[model samples]
Target: MPVSRVASRFAGIEESPTYAILDLAAELRARGESILDLNGGEPDFDTPGHITAGGTQALGGGFTHYTPSRGLPALLEAIGDKLLKDNGLSVDPARQVIVTPSAKHALFLSVMTLLGPGDELLIPTPSWVSYPAMARLAGAEPVFAPLSTDNGFRLTRENLEERLTPRTRALLINNPNNPTGNVLTATEAEAVAEVARAHDLFVITDEIYEKVRFRGEHLSIAALPGMADRTLTVNGFSKGYAMTGWRLGYVAAPEDVSAQMLKVQQHTVGCAGSFVQRGGISALTGPQEPVEEMRAAYEARRDLLVEGLSGIPGFVCPSPDAALYAFCDIGGTRFADPAAFTTWLLREAKVAVTPGFAFGPGGERHVRLAFATDPKTLGEAVDRIKTAMERL
Candidate 1:
């Protein structure tokens, strides 16, 4: 058999380092190594009981059929209602929402619908690993707008303007950001919205961590005046509801964009699972107790992880106000490349973390540690990391 040529669109895309490291650590653990995995972005807690019961009811009711391409009207309505209640934004269920298999799928569909060859996307650096790859898959160029550690890795209006160009079609914003745990302030979001308005660029906002915010409120860039018409908001049940395995997510956009995305989705995933959509409805409409419980637990874990890492020599740990990860810089210490450092840590410290460089340039000296684990395990991982650094 001859080897077939791989597609050029996927030529430079790399696997997600967080999941990749978790897999490697799991394999080692199978061989009897005690690995403390901080590389995974999933909550250690189980899915809420009410949400699980809803899925059970859905299964018992035989909801195993395909839904509309945009999603079930009930789920869409619940999503819209949830958005308005939680984020102070109104969305029309019939035209503004499309439920996807995951937030990743929603992003892919958005890129496919909005971009074409030669179109450009301005992606903030130290971003989630999938953003650039999704842009590339859509045959669009991804221009990096680097975020500084001094600014909590949040994108400012100045940074957005510096990266804008005539070919730029969209700007991606991840608030309560993955890897960095940075949430864009309302002031910063307004600035970014201004630039997008000036350039007539589509704004793609990933608010997957919206419900997981620990500090102040999670503000949507689309909530700013005039941004609602131009923003595509991507969110999911994975991070906030502990429904990662459910693989359900959604995008709310302008009617035109949602219509186009529905077409793209129909050709690709068709629709998300009907029963899962029911579960999602329960998630949005059910009690707020579980959400608050998870938030409280994660807040405690975040404090523990941040405090522990602070004591480690040569470690510069920034306090993340939201989300589940702590992104720490390990440069000027024993580690040179973050990937190599992660490998060494796994082998020596028996701890696994995602290499920061996998996120993009400017992330080379850092690593992402997910504090979604219990405090006992997280404390041990920090101790092991400190011991390993001392040895180096």
Candidate 2:
């Protein structure tokens, strides 16, 4: 038989570091290793009771079929309401929103809607692993704009402009950033708006971790002046509501742009799950206490991780402002690349962490740890990491 090959579009792309680390950890666990799996960004909590009940009710009520390709009307309205109340953005539920299977799909749809082959997207370095991959999958080039660790890895005007080219079509910002867990302040968001407006670039802001902040407040770039029309806001129930398996996410954009996104979505996965949409509605409308409780627990876990890791000889980790991760710099250690160090930690200490280079070149000497687990486990993981480094 002739040799078989995949498409040329996948030439440089690789599996997401998050999932790769997770799979390795699972395999180790299956072999009975005492592994602390800190590579995943999923919330450790279960879906809230009210939301689960809503899904059950939808199942009992026979909502097993497909919903509108855009989404169920009630879920769309609930999403819009949540945006207005929480993020200060008012959107037309009918024309401006499309719920997809996951935030990852929403992002791919956004890229397909706004970009084409040869177009470039400006992405901050050490960002979520999926953003650049999504751009590549859309046949667009990802131009990484390195955000300085000195500035808390926050995006700035100069950095965005440095990567700007005529081929550049959009800017992708993951506020409450995935690996670093840094949130953009209002001032920083304005800088992004200014640059995007000047460059005439569309902005895709992934606010999936909007509800997981620890210090400063979360600011949406879409809420900035002159940015609403050009910004596509991507959010989901995965992190905030512990609905990772539910796979419910939505994008809010200008009417015309959203309509095009819906056209792309219509041809792709078609829509989000039917009954899951009902559960999403309940997640957005029910008492927000569980969200707050989960946030508090993560915050405590973050403190435990920071305190424990700080005492180690060569680990330098800043307190994450939001999200569930700590992107720690292991540059001072003997290991120049974090991949070897992380693998050694897994083998010797039975602790799993995501290597930083998988994010971008700027993350070469770092590792990312998700603090979504309880304080006890996080503390133990930190202790093990410290002891492992001592042996090095």
Residues forming the 10-long window of minimal summed lDDT in candidate 2: 16-25
Off by over 4 Å in 2: 1-4, 18-27
TM-score of each: 0.96, 0.97
Q: Candidate 1 residues 237-341, lDDT tens each?
A: 998999999999999999988888989999988999999999999999899799999999999899999999989887898888789999999886777888888
> What is the alpha-carbon lDDT of model 2 when measured against the actual structure?
0.89
Across 1-37, the per-residue lDDT of candidate 2 in tens digits comes to 7554889889869877656667777888999889988
- Could you tell me how far off, in angstroms, the CA of residue 235 lies in candidate 2 after the best superposition? 0.2
What are the RMSDs of all candidates, in order? 1.8, 1.6
lDDT of each: 0.88, 0.89
